[model samples]
Target: MSEQRLIELEIKIAYQEDLLQELNKIIAQQQHQILLLEKTCQLLHERMNSFRLENNDEGNEQPPHY
Candidate 1:
């Protein structure tokens, strides 16, 4: 290949490497966010279940004003 063609190919390879690194970073960040959201969902589910259990325990009681 000509010198100029070889230089062009090198430049293209460099750009592709940079783009690949950036994409990898974005994917890593997304994975971290997904994990955090999953944890939050689990916590909320636990809280909801606890609340339901508490309400069930009191479900048979009458109001003070009744």
Candidate 2:
């Protein structure tokens, strides 16, 4: 292979390595964010269930007009 062609290939490889590292970092960050969102959703679901139960108990009470 010509010296110029070898140099070009090395440059391309370096750029690809950098790009892979950047993609890996982004994937890791996204995974962490997804986990946080999942936990938040679970907490919100629990709160909603509790609120519903409280509201149901209140709904059975007699009104002031009765």
Best by TM-score: 1
Q: Candidate 2: where are CA atoms >4 Å away?
A: 63-66
lDDT of candidate 1 over 2-64, digit per residue (tens) = 999999999999999999999999999999999999999999999999999999989978988
User: Model 2, residue 12: what's the lDDT?
Assistant: 100
Per-model TM values vs. the true structure: 0.89, 0.87
Give the local distance difference test score of model 2.
1.00
Q: List the residue pairs that clash in candidate 1.
A: none
RMSD of 2: 1.6
Per-residue lDDT tens digits for candidate 2, residues 1-66, read 999999999999999999999999999999999999999999999999999999999999999899
Where is model 1 more than 4 Å wrong at Cα? 62-66
Q: Which ten residues in a row are the worst by lDDT in model 2? A: 57-66
lDDT, model 2, position 46? 100
